[model samples]
Target: IYLPYTGTTIGSFGYVPMEQMEGGKAYAASDLYSLGTTCFHLLTNVHPWDLWKKQGYRWVNSWRKHLKQPVSEQLWWIMDRLLPESYQHRYQSVDQVLEVLEFQSATPANPSQSTSKYHESFLNFLTSLRQNDQLKKQVMMGGVSLLSLGLITQGYGYFRYQTFPSNLSFLIAGLPSSTYLKTTLNGHTNSVRSIAVSPDSQYLVSGSNDHTVKIWDLPKGELVRTLNGHDGNVYSVAITPDGETIASGGDDNTIKIWNLKTGELKNNLTGHQGFISSVAISSDGKTLVSGSYDHTIKVWDLPTGKLKQTLTGETNWVSSVVISPDGKTLVSGNGGNTIRIWDLDTGNLKKTLTGHRDSVVSLIISPDGKTLFSSSLDRNIKIWDLTIGELKNTLTGHIYYVHSLAISPDGKTLVSGSANNTIKVWNVETGELKNTLTGHTNWVSSLAISPDGKTLVSGSRDDSIKLWKLP
Candidate 1:
């Protein structure tokens, strides 16, 4: 689709912003103007070239004059942003444009349908305009119904019908992926720092900055018990494979064990001088690992609460730690931009994998124990071949720090929780991002997958836990 430019100009006529016509530069906003013009032409039968010949840049200001029929305020606002004469006034990126589209086309017909709901009250604006039957027919005849009022009606059945109007589907498909949001569990007084799902998939334990560990009935989303013993914020939580005991580590530099069924404080282990950042229980539920701001990875006996060994050499904070499913390896991520592989029992550091330029925020091993995924403050998720101890691939999509990583039990899908307040579902084999699920208003701090791999649980700085169906 190359356009024949007369001299210093490119891009198709009226769709081009004034800055580009003057041989300045083209930006994302310039492309947005083109999209807006296309949507306008589709809705009103008014060609952009004819308008460019008549009013030039001033045409956008009086765009409504050519409209024979009216459009909903939500649709009007979306078109208004896309058709701004100045690039500075247009939507800066495609995400911003689609964000508006999703918000405007939102449906509250069911909880699952509105899980992707951003701001519903946005449609309350621009309703004073008269309704247009012709415009609705024009959109219906054309598959691209950006101005479809049926989307705004009581039915709002895109999900109900299990289909979407063609061109609008393309836009929605690329934006935040539609997901079935199960429920939001809120109880923490502060940031919910970490979360873990029981092996039986019946319970979920969450650690929070509120200095408490709360257990919830997973199926019902009901708060079961809140264990309060940590003097400071509970930074990490890990449940045993048997689902009998839970270990919680916190800012108070203590790891407390509790009965998952009875909510009894079993033992409190203390050794590290700094705040605990992460805790992991092995698949066998025999060994427990803790990484801390104290710059060391401590291995402890899960049943007896005795300090086994402290693997040291890190000059910075140990941000996260995890045990392999086979129960033979220990991986620790630190603020020093390196991942440490250690012999779980010997406390010997085997290899220090380096690729991330910033702090490694989280680490997770594949179920098969063949691959390791590490997230970092560099905004990259690196996949490593544990056997070779080398980088396999780097997944780059998150705009902010990749805070946490979780993998389904089958090891085919990987999900990353980001500081951008969104969770990205990725295909492990191809490294392709399958979906970008957004709802949380703050940083997504931690993620856990149910044993059956059907549900995903996320803990966020918004002080809420969101359960989402695997897309």
Candidate 2:
């Protein structure tokens, strides 16, 4: 099927697919081609644009030759299907690529000499790219697509927005804002409060004030099923480390766990006397943590739904909770504009981080477990060194309350959703504002970054979830 577009060549050169360049028509596969190009550039440290002027699409055919070291033939095969010059030869759907990804990446040709040996990127086909600092920086490369013009750039936010006279004024400024968006999921009748993506990045789970948790299939952004159980507005949702279970907290003052595949209610844990605001699972998949307006954090055995410990002494209600990747430390953002560091193994408060001027609503840690990022009603994102309990950097730009934060798999980029109806992209290490994305009509309540760092999902108060193709 063909989707008509203007004849102008608006994107950075080589990343544009053949269909977009030849006939002014594009399809879903065009983005696949663009993704493949990004993968290739990550594998070979060569910008696709550098080859576009001379070799054109021909360069994609022999991409492996530029690889500095060995890449499994299996990986090369997947790229073969992705980087093909024609849509017919490419993977017809993103689901198709996801289906075969695991089988092709079971083992590398040379385990010792892996992606890092060739390039610094943690771009693995099936494996968690944060293989070891794999996600140390967010989306390893800035990705672009000419087809949708939605994903302008990745690692650095400079290219994300259709800027004013300072940047590309000729094309994007003349186009509608809808031109910057590819997918918007509308199902929840109330504001979407929080969202999470599966570890594999195939499914999205959103908790809404509509008293429902919705699971959506990726790429297609189609509603897979609607989960109903919470008695009040659903406030937070978290997919387990294994992605087989989903834990949801809400105004109901309860935590409900559901089967990821069957949508069955597996268990409901009741204890909190106040509204449950956040839920988090440890990396080991054995521990569950919840934060509530009851002014306490509860630790439970995830498999049994049995309560293990109740942490108190909080000056304000708990709003958000997150565990380090190592499963040893627990961090909670509290209503008193403070963050409490707890020892998960001992259930003791390790330290208190006080910096925000308002309630801290969101928390996310770098994959390596060395850093912690927190956002608050203060309209700021605070970066802290997790080991020493010291503040590192404070990122400020959001005009309103920062409601959510997500770090790309590369751990390089940090994306924050705000009540101002915008998503701001940041350079995690430098605390610099990369770019601001505008589309949501209401507050951007929640945000999630896919494991591969290719997609960014934002849930809004407008009662819609938008799937963004990362740059």
Highest lDDT among the candidates is held by which one?
1
Candidate 1 local lDDT, 1-471, one digit each (tens): 113233435556766667667764666556556667776675678988898897666567456567766544345445656785546446665545444445334423345434423223323311211145555334323322233233333223332233211223221223444445889999997789899999999999999988899999999999999999998779899999999999999878899999999999999999998778899999999899999887888899888888889888987788899998888889998877889998887878899999997778899999899999999867799999998899999998775568888999999999999765788889999999888888886779999999988789999977899998987
Q: Which stretches of candidate 2 lie over 4 Å from their true place?
A: 1-180
Candidate 2 structure quality by residue, lDDT tens digits, 1-471? 122244644465677788788766665567677777877776688888888777766676457668876644335545766786666446655445544543222323343333332221212322343243433222222222321121212211211111111212121222354544678999998789999999998999999988999999986889999999988779999988788999999977899999999999999999999778899999889999999877899999999999999999886778899999999999998867899999999999999998897678899999999999999866789999999999999997764568899999989999898765778778887877766777887778899989977888999877899988664
Clash counts for all predictions? 0, 13
Instruction: Supply the global lDDT for candidate 1.
Output: 0.76
Best model per TM-score: 1
TM-score of each: 0.64, 0.63
| lDDT of model 1 at position 379 | 78
